[model samples]
Target: MSKILDAFLNENLQNLRDQGLYNEIDAVEGANGPVITINGKQLINLSSNNYLGLATNEELKQVAKDAIDRYGVGAGAVRTINGTMDLHVKLEEKLAEFKGTEAAISYQSGFNCNMAAISAVMDKNDAILSDQLNHASIIDGCRLSKAKIIAYNHSDMEDLRAKAKEAKESGLYNKIMVITDGVFSMDGDIAKLPEIVEIAKEFDLITYVDDAHGSGVTGKGKGTVKHFGLEKEIDFQIGTLSKAIGVVGGYVAGKKNLIDWLKVRSRPFLFSTAVTPGDVAAITRALQMIMDSTELHDKLWENGDYLKAGLKKLGFNIGASETPITPCIIGDEKLTQTFSRRLVEEGVYAKAIVFPTVPKGTGRVRNMPIASHTKEMLDNALAIYEKVGKELGVI
Candidate 1:
């Protein structure tokens, strides 16, 4: 390593320390569940994105174990060459059916899926209109595409329409695409896809929805596209298996041709090794669970409502979240960090999100409720919130 590079790293790290932003990683000793063991102590978990709680489901565990027994540990090669297995094909088919699409393609992760799909579609000749608060993967994908990325106000359809109109009238690019998260993970607000579709129709822009947060929580666990009943409207429907599906990988579901094109051209799929058989099997089982029963989904939402009510009752500014991702808004970054540490100390595991992840002044401790949490666990978590919030003057 270069001395200058080492010096830069040290300086940046020191700056983080000075600002009290350099946080130490905490280890979770046992399985990640509704309640977890961290630092050898059991705590009520409110900071996980495991919405359906299938991450620890017995059926998924069995499927994964069975696949491991059969296919062993790793996918030995990239998908373009010889890594395509029976499990891969079946998982893709199941995913396509789940999203109500003709075809689907998988990636190593949701982040990689964004990189693969966007850069494959839009390039130097095309421009992209991205929502102001879209996830970082989308932003990085846009930059890598070498496309002109014009950011529209978050969920502001009027602003998006105006930008789309201007981009179209200019005739500077062959195609214009608009991309947004189906649910803004930061605030849990649902995207106005109906209004978005109208603008896309008017402007003839290709529409993309990254529904990572909406896949297992909305549309009766189908996705945000189904949530809005826009099965045939949105061109690209992206989602992650990691969150609610309780597996690993990401996918793009769309018309047959779009998925076919991605399969051949997306760099990650072309170069990176495919997901292991165990992961593929687990996801397929998780999908079946979502389709066969709505029990977990119902439980997740109930817990969400319960937790949000509790937080609000304790006087925390839980933003306009329409879903389970609740934000206990603490104004200052340092205080937000402090609050998170205190919560962990109090045997709760909510995580703090500060500047650069969210807006500079809107740091918050985000709590995610899952189906696995019982009423008692939620009630206990609420009490911890009350104690921590009052002690920190955040209430």
Candidate 2:
């Protein structure tokens, strides 16, 4: 009830509203699949990160229910205590195998995984070379480590090499780490990991790749690192169970020594409650499925290509994306928001990305086409896009 606090919040919120930068959340009436119902209206969903469409897979749902029936609904304590159940242990094992690592450690969420893992290994005596376009979680994790954070140009390996060489030759830090996202989410661009790994070798830098968006989508579902067959070369490979795995939680997969060290030092694992039995069981099942078949992965890319081609045919400036994530560039924030709003009104559910999330004048409506989307749904969404794009003079 402090007046100053209230005024500060009110003023900032008002500023956001005045500039049309404030976002309003829409609640889905049922399961978040390729098609979702929002406020009594059915929409062709293109905003979700359900890349492989496993989030609503019937088999995964059944497995989760069975786990709940057998193990109850929650992890009773932090992982360092009695909460490290058989399910948790099994999930870690599956993660290690799925990622082609010696061992792995899990956390409650992807954000927490970064925060816990980075700070656990790197500190003030270390320096981290990060991508300028890396995810926000990586930035926060580097900050928490209290290390010297040096940012290289986005996906520019030359810039990264220069910074890496400079940092390595400085001889001021005990360790130097290079961290980047395997796939840039907002722009849907895969990172140049192969070149990065080669550079890391020349400098003896500890390499970390956060493959949150790449898991179950790239490398035939093994991820970006394995996509280039550098699985063993990268020191730390971080993944999330939430995105394409279609469940929840995050993990760090590496050597046994690294996993063992994380178990002893990661603050989130030591202090926060573990993922539930149902989540662990479901995640394990999902990984097993992803490893077994590439059907969903292929279907996902099919839809992505279908949608992108349609958008391009209609004269929309879809960005240069190498993944299933498609961004229709609008270039102006207000118009971009208007475009998204009109799309929703016309039964599409893609959202706009503007300043703070993406650089200014690069505003876009990002579309994530999953395996569950039918050709019919994509066609309808395209129809809506053509109508809105033309009306807004964007095409």
Candidate 1 TM-score, true structure as reference? 0.98
| Model 1 stretches astray by more than 4 angstroms | none
| lDDT of the structure predicted as candidate 1 | 0.92
| Candidate 2 ranges with C-alpha deviation above 4 Å | none
Residue 249 in candidate 2 has what lDDT?
94
* TM-score of each prediction: 0.98, 0.99
TM-score of 2: 0.99
Candidate 2 — worst ten consecutive residues by lDDT sum?
16-25
Give me the overall lDDT of model 2.
0.93
Note the Cα lDDT for every prediction shown: 0.92, 0.93
Candidate 2: tens digits of C-alpha lDDT, residues 1-395: 89999999999999877766888888899999999999999999999998988899999999999999998999899988899899999999999999999999999999999999999999999999999999999999999999999999998988989999999898999999999999899988999988999999999999999999999999999999999999889999998889999999999999999999999999999999999999999999999999999999999999999998999899988877999989999988889899999999999999988888888789899999999999999999999998988898998
